[model samples]
Structures are given as C-alpha cells and as structure tokens.
Target: MSMYCNQCEQTAKGIACTTHGVCGKDPEVSALQDLLVHAVMGLSLYAVEGRKKGITDPEVDRFTVKAIFTTLTNVDFDPARFQNYINEAVAMRDKLKERVGVSFDHNSANFQPASDVAGLTEQGKQVSLDSDKETDADIQSMQQILLYGVKGVAAYADHAAILNQTDEKVYAFIQEAMAALTRNDLEANDWLGLILKCGEMNFRAMELLDAGNTGTYGHPTPTAVPLGHKKGKAIVVSGHDLKDLEELLKQTEGKGIYVYTHGEMLPTHGYPELKKYSHFYGHYGTAWQNQQKEFANFPGAILMTTNCIQKPQESYADNIFTTGLVGWPGVHHVDGHDYGPVIEKALAMPGFPSDEDNGTVNVGFARNAVIGVAPKVIEAVKGGAIKHFFLVGGCDGAKPGRNYYADLVEQAPKDTVILTLACGKFRFFDKDLGDIGGIPRLLDVGQCNDAYSAIQIALALANAFDCDVNELPLTLILSWYEQKAVAILLTLLHLGIKNIFIGPSLPAFITPNVLNVLVENYNLRPISTPEKDLEMILG
Candidate 1:
C-alpha cells in the first residue's frame, strides 16, 4: 500500500514519504498512524456530542491526546500497539455515547476496526493524507497544519500529564478539534483559522507543561553541565521528560550507576531538585538526529523517554530502553517507572574508560533564571552595551543544512546577545561566544516548552524599550523539525512577532497559498545562509 506522510521538516526530499517514511516508519507503521488518526476522529465525533451534554470523559480526553501524539513521526512504530489504541478508542467513544444519550451515527466516530492487522492496513489505506480528494490544495494544507499542530500540543500535554498535571481546557480542545475534521462544511479559511487557534491552545499547553516542571522540580537556574563525562557505569537518558530521568536517578541513587542526560534531556540538569542529585551528571551526544552514532558509541544503556527517537542501531539495540510514548519494536520498554532492568543493564556494562573532559555547556536559563537578571539586561541594552537579541532555537535535526544555526551564532556581531533553547542549541552550545561583562552572550533558556519563558523575556524587553514586541530590537531565527515547532511558530505569529527567520526547510504540509498567507500577514521568512540571514536580521 502507498503512504503519504510529510508531517516533519525532514520529510523525504522535503515532500511526503510515499513508499516508506524517512524517519524509519515503514509502510505498515505509516498506515497505522493514519488508522489511528481516523480512529481519533471517530472518537472526537462522539466526544463532541458528549461535551454538548456536559458529560465529558477525562479518560477519553487523555486517550485522544495521547493517541494523536503516539502517531507522530518517529513514535510508536509497532503496528500491534496502534491497533490496541484504536480498539480502545472505540470503547471510549461508545462509553461517551452512553453518557450523551446520543445514538450512533455510523460515521467514522463509531466505526470499528477490523479484527486483524491486514484489515487494519486496509482501513488505513483509505485514510492517508493524499486520499482526501479536496481539489483545493490550500485547504488540504491547512487541514494538515491543524492536525500537525495539535499533535505537538498533545505531546507537550502528555509530558505534563505524566507529572500529574492536566489542563481540562487542553484535553477538551484536542477532542473538539479532532471532531472538526470530520465535518465537510468547513472551508479552507475555516481550517486556517482553526490552525491559528490550535497554536493559541498550544501556548496554553506549553505553559501548563512549564508550570508542571517548575512546580515539581523547582525553577531552572543557570548551571554548568559537562559535555564529556564518560566515567563509571554510565547510563545516558535522552529525550525531554524530566520525570523519567528523576525516577531513574532515584532508583540508581546509591547503585553507583552514573546518570547522564542526552539531547533535550540536557536542560534537566538545571532544575533544583534534579541538579541536587550528586550523580545526575553532565550531557552526552548532540540532538535527536545523531542517536544512531551517539547511542552506538555510548558505554552503557540508553533510555529514551519521549519523542525524537530514531530507529535504534543493532550495535546498541540490546541496551536501548524506551519509556512512555517512545517505542521501537524490539527495544526494551520501561513502564510503571520500573527502572530495575535498565539499572541492571547499566550496572552490567563496562563503565566509561575515562573522563574525556570535553569541556562544558551552560543551560537552565528559564524564566525565573533570566527574569532575575532582567534589570541588568535592560540596563545593558539601554547603555548601548548590547546591540541586538537573537533567539536562535527550536528542534534540532540531522540535516546537513542545520550547521547554519551554529554558524549564525558563531558569526553574530560582538555586541549582540544570543538567547537559545530546546535541542537546537546543541549545535552551538559548545561554542564560546564571549560575554557582556559578567553575563554570557549565549543564554540557554531551558527546553522547547520553555518558549513561554522566551516570550516573557521578549515582553519584558519590549516593556523596557517602550515598544511593541515586534518593534523591539529582537529577531527570531528558528530551525524547526516536527509538530512542536509548528505550534511555537504559530504562537510567535499569534503574538505579531515579525521578520522571524525559519529554516532549514519549510513544512511540507503548507501549500504555496497558505505559505503566502503567513508571509503576507506575518513577514515570516525562510532563513537564508548564515552570512546572508545575519545581514538581514542585523540590518
């Protein structure tokens, strides 16, 4: 069966993945994701009716959020697992149907899947992105945009949920938005508006996730983390979830296993509670794209807790462990916070031969961390000590063009201050960009969810400079990979932030017309070369 998946920035040749997903999602897995989306749409139809009756199911809401998140690129490659989620979704929808006193409409919202994998594959074939024969390419693009943006929202919300943080508003929007897709009356413009609304809702989801993180782990503060620490029985934990890392830390507390962070997990070192752990040491690897090589070379077990998981290499497959929403067919999965096997594997492996001393990278400049130094930054800006502020961050990938981000920061003028977050910062985190007096020129503002922190810092700068945020001497040079970047880009556009530079490539989901609308309304531009983009932003 043919497939069509272009949900990530790194889609094959910058277009839909037809035969096989570039992210290692084979035809079967791609079909399952389509089926899962169809199932969610089915559940949303009933959930919508249930909401009208003031009888919403929190469990259904959670399921809808997670089901969509699991279908995202590079997540949940196991078709068998997706089949379970789909059948479970049908049950949840029926339960809601009983509560709303609404009879089944026999629409996709109530349709059951076939009993076998072949049947599920047949069902999925009809639901691929290309199968929707809406002649208007722009409307088709907008629909894809909304679905992708919501997937990002679900991922962030799922992270917060694991921390015991749930926003009913977010869950409600997830189902309501999915239900909107089943209706044919909505036009391209309608879907476009909904996409922006998803962006706004995503802002709230990210805010809740941020609140959950700070509430549990305490606010992030500026902390220096080692980049090369290969000592002892090392276990490198990657992805963005801090809760899983904390649990691993607790279980390995006195076990003598060295717990190091990798990729997005690098920001966890800045949290007060997490940083308190003596063995919660340093970072390993770079971004999500380098996992095959990085994980292969690591001395011990690798645990991935969230999105941005690559197909594990056989070299490290035996030691790779997946948890939460992350999955790769044969890899070990840890559930119920049981790190017993992971610990056992780490302990059994030979420890790092010696500490390489690869120097250090600084992170944890979240809202509280940066805002405390706001007055000083404001003074620096007013005194002509700081020339411009460039927020260069987002999801990092393995694209060869991604080196532009590191070069952009490296080549910035002497007086400019660079603010960065998320895994993208890994490109230049090791580069020494000098400092303004005691303040570092490159400020690490935690993870991608901490984008709200970037917004707060931007607003504060605007207030200090006495201008609209767009009027301030700030530029957003972003590089996006997946749906989370879509949500953040929409948030920036929603706030009227202008002249933002985004690259390595634009999303394949956006049609030429929809792309024009964004460009005309927001002046959002794709990034050029480091030399060229820097000139445009600085000028």
Candidate 2:
C-alpha cells in the first residue's frame, strides 16, 4: 500500500483507503500530512514542557492547533501547502526546543526531516498510521481515537481563537495529549483515561467556540431562510466561518451582488449582525456531499471558508475560491481578512437570472432562543403535547445508508421535536415537520461548531423538568463522518451520555475490544432502522 487513510466515514471498502483517499486525497499529499502530524507532535513535546515552566507562547499554541487541523479530512489536499507546513512545524519545534532546554529520547522528539518534499514524504511513510505494527491493536485504536479527537479540538480552538476567544487550559491539554502519544509507557487503561480526557477538553474547546461565535455575531435568533435564489449577481459562501462570511457580506453591500449561505453556513443567516445585510440571501444547496452537483449549477462565485471542499468539477472549478485553512491545488486562495477578489469574481459572473421562491427552512433555534421560550416548552412537555425530543445530526457524507436519517426524521411522530445541527441536517432540512403547541418541530441549532448550544438546550430541559438529562424523554440519533464528529462523540461520553444511537456505520478504526469498551461503558448502539430504533427508544 502506498498510502492509508480512514479518517472519514466513506473510507473505501468499509475499511481503509490504501492507495488514495476516498475523499480524493492522493498518496503524496497523504504522506506530507502524516509528516506534518509527526512534526506537530514534536512541537507539542516542547510545548508541554514549556507549560510546566509557566511559559507559554501564544504563537506556538495557535500554530500547533492550526497545523493539526490541516490534517483533518477534506481540509487540505495541496502537497506544496503541506510541504510548507512541514518545514514550519520543524522550525517551530526546534525554536521551542531551544527555549525549553530539555531533550527527550523518543523518536518524535528527536526526529529530523530531510529538507525536501520527497525526503519528507519518505520520512512520513515511516511514521504513518500503520508504522507501529508492534503495538496492541486495541491500544492502537485508542491512539487513533485520541489523535482524531485532538484534530477536532484543534479545528474548534482555531475557530475560537480567530474570534479572540482563547483559553490556555485548552491549549495545555492539546499539547499534553499530543505529547502523551509519544510515550511508550502508558498501558491500555492509561490510554482509555486519556481518551476520555480528550473528550473533557473538547467540551471546553466547544464552550469557548460558542462564546466566541455568540459574542461576535450575537445569539442566533429563529429566522427563515429561502431555499431559492433572487435575480442578481451573487456569491455563495460555504463551510463554517462566520467571520469570513461577515467580511464578504460587508464588502458586497450595495454592489448588486447577493450573498447566499451553503452547507453549514445556513445558520449564519440567523445572526443579527449578518442578517442585517439586505443582499445576504438564502441557502443554495444541501450537504457538502452534494456540492459537486449543487456548485456546478450555482451561477455565482463560491467561497469555501473552511473544510468540506470536494475536488471541484471542471465546470465550476474556475468559479470557486478557498479561504482560511481549506485548500486544493490550482484553486485560488483568499486571505480571510479580505473579500475583494471574491467580490470581483461575483461581479464578473452571471448570478441568478430570475427570482425563484422555492420556499424556506427555519434555523437559529440555538440555546438562547430555545431557553428564552422555556416556559412554554416546559408546559408543552408537562402536558404531553411534546412526547419526546430527538437530537439528530452529525457530519453528512456521500455514502449509502445515509437515507436512514431522512427516513427516521420522516417517520418520527408529530408530537416529537427534532433538534439538528451540522451538515447532516441537510438530510431532512426542507421537510415540513410542522409544530408542537406552537413550537416548530424541526429546530436548526446552527453548525457543528454550535454543538455546545444543543447541549445547553438539553440541560435546560432537564433542569426545568427536575430530572437528570438521561431521564428526560430525549434521544440522540447521530450520524458521523469525520474527526469533528468523533470529538463530539467523545464529548458526549465524557458528559456520561448513554444510549446514543449512531450510524450509518461505526468508525473503521475501532477494534472489537475497543468497541466493547464503548458499548459496556456508554451503552452506545448502532442504528438499525429508524422504525425499529424509534420503537425501542419510545418503548
């Protein structure tokens, strides 16, 4: 095998992708990504030491998080970009090593890269996920879980830091966890403990991100966004960055160009600061998986602010631009602070030729909005007007068996409320689930970044009913696709959440022993059919 990647749900053959990634990542790029992760692990070794000495470099903290984020699925497939990141990671690691005045005997701490891309790629192969064939399969599974969870944390931490929300403890845990991966002394129990710790820290990371988003954009309010387009020059913004969307919205004002949200950006329409822009129109497509078709038909410039980028089809390849940490070779890259190029592209293109009222989807039922109407919600639940609550969302993917989510939502009883977040909601976002006692049954709780909001809503309901959250008539039916979903699952486990029904499939990385650990401790189960699971859950 020239390469190995199974970080996402659609890994080839329900196992690993050996030659190239199912997500279009080639072997050379995969090698560089592996090298980048190894380099960051070295830097983390010193960063962990620095924290013990009461010395922390904000630059190191920020770079460490951002570098780990780049290795996540579909974030970057550019070999040159990864090459540059590899060099930078080594330089940062050496600089921190000089300051810490400490040495480790481990290979991760002392490893040096050859100065060229080919050399680095070769070195990366030595440290690839399969390199450690001597370790126990269960321990290896735990390591993958830990590493992937940290990747998710870094993504959120980077997003939070962008909005000026920084927490040193979060950074500390990240460095410590990465550094721990280099240790050969830890046992299975030790790895399990660290795995749960990763989840606990993710909770903090998500909380900080929540504060950053709401503090910057104001709490999301329930808003209706159109599913159709209006006649105008247009730009469609995808991914999860509100700041980038805000910059574009600001630049496009009075320019006769309409700005639309795509994928997870749909929830940004509920933000007061963003929605004030008259031309910031509505959503344009479904989940990220469907973007190849959706983007081809979109007659406007597309700006992808974060991950979830598919290889652009030739038809719309020239019309798409990537900003922030997301990148693809040959695609134009924009600095997050500026939107002039994107605006120019939109102005040059022919946007919607006519107005189309394709109806609307309601979003922004975040923690604050839902909690604001707590009295009515409590009354409804107490009177049995709302029989149950279902939190059903995760990263949406291109794989089969995903229709199970749509079927589940469609089959859910009318008296139940569905709270969804992330791109997974695209499965049934347009369905008219109607309302229960004046409360809309289908509630959009912002992006996956806003998982914190969903947790708060569940907690608030539990408090009002004077029962533990597990005792409430609430069920978590989740679908996962990537590292972010893994991190969120760990967070749920850390919070002692049980009986979570997750599908279209379980992660390929989990060995049966590790699987049993989760099953025994958390009561985690795979989804059967929505009908069977709902019957079991309701019974």
In model 1, which runs have C-alpha deviations exceeding 4 angstroms? 103-106
* lDDT for position 245 in model 1: 90
- Give lDDT tens digits, candidate 2, residues 377-457: 999988989999999989899899999999999999999999999999998999999898789999999899999999999
RMSD of each: 1.3, 1.0
Which residue window of length 10 is worst by lDDT in model 2? 335-344
TM-score winner among the candidates? 2
- Model 1 scores a C-alpha lDDT of 0.86
Candidate lDDT values, in order: 0.86, 0.91
Go through the candidates in order and give the clash count of each.
Answer: 1, 0
Best by lDDT: 2
Residues 261-338 of candidate 1: C-alpha lDDT, one tens digit per residue? 888888899999999999988888888888898888988988988787888888989999999878888889998889
